[model samples]
Target: MAIQKNVLRVADLPQKKPTQFDIQPEAAQLDQITDQLELSALRKVRFKGVVAPIGQRDWELTAHLGATVVQPCVVTLAPVTTRIEEDISRLYLRELPEISEGSEIEMNTDDTVEALPATLNLDDILIEALALALPLYPKADDAALTQAAFTKPGEKAMTDDDARPFAGLASLRDKLNKDSDGSA
Candidate 1:
């Protein structure tokens, strides 16, 4: 069966067949998402996918997410627009691997595997995937970081070259060598 609602109960689904789903947020929903994500704008977004039973108990969801987002440039604060298209895969397992308490366990290699939930909320998955796919530091095409120095009025401002710990030592060594050669 095709699904459109935001939430789906696993027990209510047909156990033998894959269920297709498509989600497109309305304008108000988009605005809520934009605010929730701290985005300047979320003009469009869509998620379409299929959930299928794996074996007798487990399930898997595979989806494609597309979005047009706007965020401030990290350096210049100008609006930076980005088009995002991502494919997402998640496996719902009836039983997750065991990790004993107080034991140092290596991180699981597969991040997509998750414990099966009684009900799956499509909106939560869509928001999570969108959040993960967004660029951490969005930059406009012409945005650049310019350097500036700050100091007290009477004090010399420190530049990048001067900030190096050994920079002054090199000039001091050169002067010392010149003096020794002249004395010799």
Candidate 2:
């Protein structure tokens, strides 16, 4: 879901150039995260964003960010440190109509602009960048070894169960198919 209120409006923020940002307290705890599923992870986040004005209703935001995501070993549940780096760009538009919700809305990509604000929220930009940095599946090397240890040596692999329980369906279908083919 979109972080509804968290995104700072372009008009509301200053149009100043992008600058480096370092968030404390919030970031300082990053190393403390050890796979607490029910809790927000601690993370050190750093990012830089540059805004280029396009037209009256648009701007191009380019950003790069880095974070350390404390993931767990898939097998042993040990804390695994994962480093992430991301480069993101977005075309910010004002007053987007619901009918044109598709990404077809044209934007001036050629670095043209009517104006920019003096400054903007750096946290929102970093949050967005970090969100993208989240990995689909995180695992540690030990986790792989743990799973490998669960298998039996030289054991036969089990077959996946067929979802349709009627094992005779294939034979019956073959008979019917033969009848139909013969008639044709």
Q: What would the TM-scores of all predictions be? A: 0.91, 0.51
The segments of candidate 2 whose C-alpha lies over 4 angstroms from its true place after superposition are: 1-9, 12-43, 97-121, 145-184
Give the Cα lDDT of each candidate.
0.93, 0.54
For residues 28-70, could you state the per-residue lDDT of candidate 1 as single tens digits? Answer: 7888789889999998799999999999999999999999999
Residue 8 alpha-carbon offset, candidate 1, angstroms? 0.9
RMSD of each: 3.4, 8.8
**Model 1 TM-score relative to the real fold:** 0.91
Clashes of each: 0, 10
Worst 10 residues of 1 by lDDT: 1-10
Model 1 root-mean-square deviation: 3.4
Q: Write the per-residue lDDT of candidate 2 for residues 62-95, one digit (tens) a residue.
A: 7767666776555667776778888867655554
Cα misplacement distance, residue 178 of candidate 1 (Å): 3.2
Using lDDT, give the best candidate's number. 1
